[model samples]
Target: MFGDLMGMMGKLKETQEKVEATKKRLDTVLIDEQSTDGLLKVTITANRSIKSLKIDDALLEDKEQLEDYLILTLNKAIEKATEINETEIAAVAKDGMPNIPGMDLFK
Candidate 1:
């Protein structure tokens, strides 16, 4: 019983290390997305931090449209960042808990 407990603790430590590594990797991962009309572009890190934004000069004439496109493009970039974050975390979980049966269900 003590051995099993130690093994579980070891696994937990490994999982925590993997999670930390994933977070560091996420800081460097970025997602870029643009509005449907290609007027606005947004770049966000996997940690959901906005790194940069770009807008076409033509869209500057309409403040309302520009705001709308900015919101849309930002949301798209954030969504992609979330997907990448989840995937990386799931991979860490899988790698750290390989001994668990049916663990793929968590992924």
Candidate 2:
């Protein structure tokens, strides 16, 4: 029993290290996708928050349309960020505890 407890503690420590490494890897990856025409660009953090947005002034001629496009593009960016998070969570869970059901406690 003591040996098993020690093994579990070792596994937990390894998992914590992997989680930190994964976060660092994600931090370097850019989720900055832009509109098709490049009129709008959005940068999102690894944790799914908007870091910044750049809009070309040329799109402002049609203010309403620009507004709508901005909304749409930001939504797309948000979705992309969420997908990244899901992928990361799954990867970490699978790496750490492949045999457990619903092991995504880190997300």
Measured by lDDT, the strongest candidate is: 1
Model 2, 37-82: lDDT tens per residue?
A: 9889999866666788888988879989798888888888878877
- RMSD values, in order shown: 2.0, 3.7
Query: Which candidate should be chosen as best, given TM-score against the real structure?
Result: 1
For candidate 2, the lDDT comes to 0.78
- Taking the tens digit of each residue's C-alpha lDDT, what string does model 1 give over 7-107? 97999898999899899999999888998787888888999999988889999999998988988888888888999998999888877774655556664
The global C-alpha lDDT for each of the candidates, from Candidate 1 onward, is: 0.87, 0.78
TM-score (C-alpha) between model 1 and the true structure? 0.87
Runs off by more than 4 Å, candidate 2: 98-107
- Clashing pairs in model 2, backbone N/Cα/C closer than 3 A: none
My TM-score estimates for the predictions, one after another, are: 0.87, 0.72
Q: Ten-residue segment with the worst summed lDDT in candidate 1?
A: 98-107
